[model samples]
Target: MIHSKRSDRNNISPQAGLLIWAIIFLVLATAVLNMPGYPSGLKPATFLKLPLEVPLTGLALLVLSGLAARLLAFFSTLAIGTVLFLRLADIGVQSAFQRRFNPYLDAKMIADGWNVLSGSIGTLTAASLIIATIAVFILVLLLLFTAQVRLADAKPPITGNLRLVFGSLAGVGLIFFTASQFDGMRQYASLQTPSYLTARLTLISKSMDDMRHFDQDLAARAEKTTDEYLFRGVAGRDIILIFIESYGRSAVEDSRYAPLIQPRLASVGDALTAKGFSAASGWTRSPTMGGLSWLAHGTFLSGLWVDNQARYDRLMISDWPSLNSMFRDSGWRTAAVMPAITMAWPEAEYYGYDQIFAAADLGYKGKTFNWVTMPDQYTLSAFDRLVRHPAAEADKPVMAEIALISSHAPWTPVPRLIDWLDVGNGEIFDRQAESGDPPGVVWADDQRIRRQYIQTIDYSLHTVGDYVAKFGDDAVFVVLGDHQPAPLVTGPDASRDVPIHIISRDRNLVRRFEAEGFSPGMIPAEDAANPPMDSMRGKLIRIFSQAQ
Candidate 1:
């Protein structure tokens, strides 16, 4: 009798085991369905609300059985995983670019992100991180799949009238969601996973519509007239258009940075004045902020708002003549010194450059400063050696676009200004690149990151100022910022306006820019003309091509 009683106590019914598994599945599904889409939404209140998708999924599982039930479970799990992944992507993109991710247009950003990651922290470590992330995502899918399958196999006793409860909850959720779409009921609405997915779908549809309109605009631009006398006013002088990476107005306006940067700008201006150079500064709004610099470049060169990858790609294939091509047409040798382009650039054909100096062609033999290929000083020195000082193109009058990347992200070990005569082959910067704490160590602290950003901007300013002071004999220098730094360095509400300065020895050339609302000194006034980046291509051609 005692043995039989012990056996009965130790063994439990299969129904009880199934009921326990059902409860586990419910908890897991609830947790996933309650996940937030943005970092700011990560609060206890976010999880306290229920997701309508959970109840609807549970109801479907209860109504179906056998193959039908398993198939429903599989697709539901996939949908949940997709929504979760998009939420995470949105969080990451918002942190870097101050915007949400658009899967329709931003798919290329994945490859771009990989390149930046590998460049920041060796290729091997980046590969390992990618593998680990994939592994974690697969593990999550498998767990969700297992829990769903077990719940679908539950019997009547285990389910215990759950179908009725799930149906009632789903019905109420649908009504509330529909009502929330109305103006009067919006205040009562709360964010849920299903609503987030619906919103994403709406965004995708809008992006597609925007692309169509953009294509129409591109067609209209291709039909515009091209001035025969473009760049005719500055025909004899060499034109150097320099784009300073991440050199936004915040460097000269933010309280955290202006104290250190304004004085440096003033000193650089004084030094240039002593060398008989005049500078005119003003603000211009960039189409993009915090990375994807090609967008800003395309906007400036194409004379159209190329804010997304789709627009940029379309502009490349369109009949629009780039600013470089326009200069080349007007009897000036065109060149591009892009140190950041380490791979094949088929788009260079569209830019119409007679000579292209990529990273490999610059002949830099120094250590890289994390992601930055070489210092601004080296880029400027190399440009002078290859394009300016060379006697081969002395009479041609060159127009070149040199990209200075020293102020780019992962700003560390900012290189100091060395004498131009001493900057031979860039070997002098190796020690400075290797001396400071690595990117990982510095980026861990927000204060350190801000400080480093300001320092690098100061270094870049000095490099450009000193280079022009030493090299501006008969050349016109157009220096501007590509875009603002990432949101991590600048606060979330920062503007997308960047400062542009035109420097030259000819006071007449300076007066032309001032006529377009540029200030007299290095600092742009708060009330100066703030044009959109796309307007510069047309405004510049019109300004410099006029009879003077």
Candidate 2:
């Protein structure tokens, strides 16, 4: 009875309840302070005020009704963690519980991320997390025991509320730390927010914008300019539109960067000239840089600039026709070959392709380094196999959209000849080449990455050029850069422009593009006064549809 009375009296003290929290603050501060570099730009006041910050801030917020209870925080942590996990799982290879998450990874559905400071957490990361969590629990307990801390308030809430508060706080701390480290959480995640966030944002859209922006334009363009794209009795030739990862005209124009490579592409371009094939180039606006390759690819494919996770989700739910599905309606064999995607993506099914080939469908012939899949050459090779569909309806044309990834990040193990392509140990990612080397002669900057990317494009274009020459008017090819490289090439912006090139043996295809006020050049439709990426889909489709 005496001991029970003493324990009850002890519970009244803030020093007893808060002893662990105080220790946690010190431990966290120490760990963060000891990071590789010194913390700059932080004021001494910020450092000094931290000890009192947590509780004092709580009190201040409470006075202002801004203080959120620990229970709410705990749930927020779990909700956000689940959101992050789901996002990764949606694009993951291994199962959600076992696999890691990568946010800034250059390739699609990558098992990990690529930033020097951030990356996906795999088994090693998970084990570390479990250990750290235990350590935090122990440390907090030790501090409480040592300090005999208790709450500052004299009158206390029920004991059940106390447990909820502590439990929630622990959960909140764990998630807060994780979110700080995970790239996806920082930039692309919003799971903690209410579900109505989407409805609220979309509801803000003005009704002035109508579906006619998409439908009427098609109807009008078809009525007036449809004749040229149609060749005699041909409905629509099988369109094999490809986006060679980072292919761009700048790779050719910048001689000092790729003196040897630029000429090879120019030579390849010139050779096509005499073969009655002409190449015209233009630009599209890429929404992001360094990463988010999918957003650009999504914009081109869906004919909508899908800039965020929300936009990406809404489209997936829609029954609207993608370019591939549109071709499917024409009785064309529609397929998408994505070598970068290691696992199946739900978005692929939504887009409506007759057959979808993922990385599993691909033959991973050991090409790697700086983390990537086979070269674009292999993708083209795969396409060639698909092209000779021996059993399918021979009369029906095919529409194949292929994405080439060899030109992607950590450009290394880049083969001089496509046949010799092997990612191998990625020695190139580590090598330091002289800055002045031509495009073919790899350099050390973004251009080095670009050189590799552009060469892949050159090779793919040349390959397409060769394919056309061999096929002899049986097919049509559309090739362009899905998006610009990154901040290294084009700085981060909503409006950074990307180059778009349309190459074909068909003169009418080129004519159709020009009649819409877009001629050969790396340019977006954005004029001194024109619409932005918002208008790209309707235009490209209206032009390409005519070939039907």
Candidate 3:
């Protein structure tokens, strides 16, 4: 009788341990199910879940309660944790890019971002994050190896049978409940895990399909290309296209910065008016956001919606007829003044520019403002000396794309506009560069960040206005933003719309874009139906290339 009693006690003990482990696992699984970043609103309550797998996992543990079960439990925990972490990362990447993260497509961008990681995350913070991540991973590994998993320990036959029966009941109840509320539960994930794995697989397949279709379309466009030039109307006029960095519509339209920014904008308008230059402003939806200025540049120039890096690479390699190519073909000297491009740009040849002025090529010996290679005032000064002045002396018509990047992220130590004549070699503004607050100090608070952003933008506008006041007599200038500021600056729900302005001495030049919905005098009118950035290439070509 004592032997039977002891046997019963042993059976109950193991069963009790198994039940406790099952409850803990269910709670953990439920927490994961109710986790954030599940398509914005599909996360269900923890208690409302039908976790059939929770009991099943317990049953498996109880059945295999040896070293093997312990290893299995450890690996399972590791795998689930890794997946949840990846889901969170995917959501972050999506917030930046409007699409889901594709490892194949985004891996290169990630590597490229590492080059500027210091400007992004401070060195100490990055090191700490790396160390913390490694420590957590090692800790998880050690715990899994050492954790006592006694769920599968041998028990009485009745105890084992009871576990199986209980698991069976849970599984059956889960199915019945799910079926009864099948329609309502459609939005809820059964296991509480997100569909990130399935979405990733789908993204891979879709990427392949898109590449094939893009190649076919590019080939068709290549075959249809002609050498006919239609730029006779503005043939001998100098045209300048300046892409301002991170100058989105939110700066001018959103309430946060609009009030602070509008007065400066109006001041610029007044300055331009004082210089006898008429200006029109409007909005264009950019293809990419935050950091991909090149994508917006490619889209604007090529008249193609170059949204992703893969598409941009393909567009660069293809013999695409762009604004520069058309201008070059029509007896105009085409050049690109890219102060941000510090390295070799073989793509300049593909874009059909006769000359390319990169960061090193621009004669500026000033201190770098973090990522901004040269100040806008210096860039304009160099452009005037190298391109505009020379072209004017030689009586050569010029078409150039100037990428002005002084207002880029980490907007620190912004150069104050000195006298235009004193901007020679860009050395006179060295004092101003040293005077402004450091990016680290400026970015410590949100209010300071916004203040610096506003100041930098005002500097860019004043620089442009100064350029026009000095050089507006001989050219038509199209100045616009490359893309919106990062989400941290613009908030999460910011639009991709960027402000574009056209300043010219010729009323006809400004009037041509009126039909296209551009408002007169610097501030773009509120137009809900503004065209995309890609459409500007065709519109400009149509308006300027007409028979006069």
Q: Give candidate 1's whole-model lDDT.
A: 0.84
Give candidate 1 regions above 4 Å deviation.
Answer: 1-28, 121-125, 161-195, 223-228, 527-529
Order candidates by TM-score, high to low.
Answer: 1, 3, 2
Q: What are the per-residue Cα lDDT tens digits for candidate 3 across 245-363? A: 88888888878788877888898889888878888889999997777788998999999888778888888888778888888877778889999898777777778988889999888
The CA lDDT at 166 in model 2 is 42
lDDT (CA) per prediction:
0.84, 0.49, 0.74
User: For residues 267-311, could you state the per-residue lDDT of candidate 1 as single tens digits?
Assistant: 999999999999999999998888889999999988888888888
Cα lDDT of candidate 2 equals 0.49
lDDT of 2 by residue, 44-150 (tens): 43332122223322332222211233333334334333333333332221221112232222233333332311221234454575567558545644443232222
Worst 10 residues of 2 by lDDT: 91-100
Among these predictions, the greatest lDDT belongs to 1
The residue ranges of model 3 lying beyond 4 angstroms of the native Cα positions read 1-35, 38-61, 64-82, 130-194, 223-229, 391-395
Judged by whole-model lDDT over C-alpha atoms, candidate 3 comes out at 0.74
- TM-score of model 1 relative to the true fold? 0.90
Candidate 3 clash figure, as a count: 1
